[model samples]
Target: MTRMKELRKKKGFSQVRMQMLTGIDQSDYSKIETGKRNMSFEQCRRIALALETSMDYLAGLTDQDTPYPRTK
Candidate 1:
């Protein structure tokens, strides 16, 4: 499974829940998960936040799933 999908499942979130959390449509989220579509930077940021993971992890740049501390 893609890192995004895996993280989503690990968080116990469905695509519909993802839409609610990320403002991404379920169909489009599905495509993104399946690698049939690409997500914008904003979308990626939202997904990472919703999934409580780092964008670097989602991009396979790092194996660490823990997100970095956020600042205001």
Candidate 2:
């Protein structure tokens, strides 16, 4: 699954709700989540902000996906 879908689920955000929060259309958001559409860096950043996740995590560049790192 794409990071979008994973993060959305983790945040308990539905497609419509996420779209509303991100000012993106539901269909477009769905496409982005499915990787059927290419999202811009700004769009990804917005999603990361909305999901309370880091851009690196959203882009799968790192395993530390959570917005806030867990304190040991």
Candidate 3:
């Protein structure tokens, strides 16, 4: 499973709920989670935000799941 799917499940979110949080359609979200579709950068940002994680974590670029330091 994709890290997105793993994170979603860990957070107790279903595809429908992920869609609701990410503003992506349920079917599209399912495809993204299942690795059938590539998500755009904006979609990744949204999903990361919704999951309270960093884009790097979602993309598996880093094992650390904490978001980067926020700057105002």
State which candidate has the highest lDDT. 1
Tens-place lDDT digits, model 3, residues 1-72: 378888888999999998899899999988888888999999999999988899999888999988898889
What residue runs in model 1 are displaced by over 4 Å at the alpha carbon? none
Which residue pairs does candidate 3 place in steric collision?
A: none
Estimate the TM-score of every prediction: 0.94, 0.84, 0.92
RMSD of 3: 1.1
Q: How does each model score on lDDT?
A: 0.91, 0.83, 0.89
Q: What's the best-to-worst order under lDDT?
A: 1, 3, 2
- Give the least accurate 10-residue stretch of model 2, judged by summed lDDT: 63-72
lDDT per residue (tens digit) for residues 1-72 in model 1: 299988888789899999999999999999999999988889989999999988898888999999999999
Q: After superposition, how far is residue 49 of candidate 1 from its true place, in Å?
A: 0.4
Displacement of residue 13 (Cα, Å) in model 2 is 0.9
Best by the TM-score measure: 1
**Candidate 1, 10: how far from true, in Å?**
1.2
- Prediction 3 global C-alpha lDDT: 0.89
Please give the lDDT score at residue 2 for candidate 1.
Answer: 91
What is the model-wide C-alpha lDDT for candidate 2? 0.83
In candidate 2 the C-alpha lDDT for residue 17 amounts to 96
Tell me the alpha-carbon RMSD of every candidate. 1.0, 3.9, 1.1
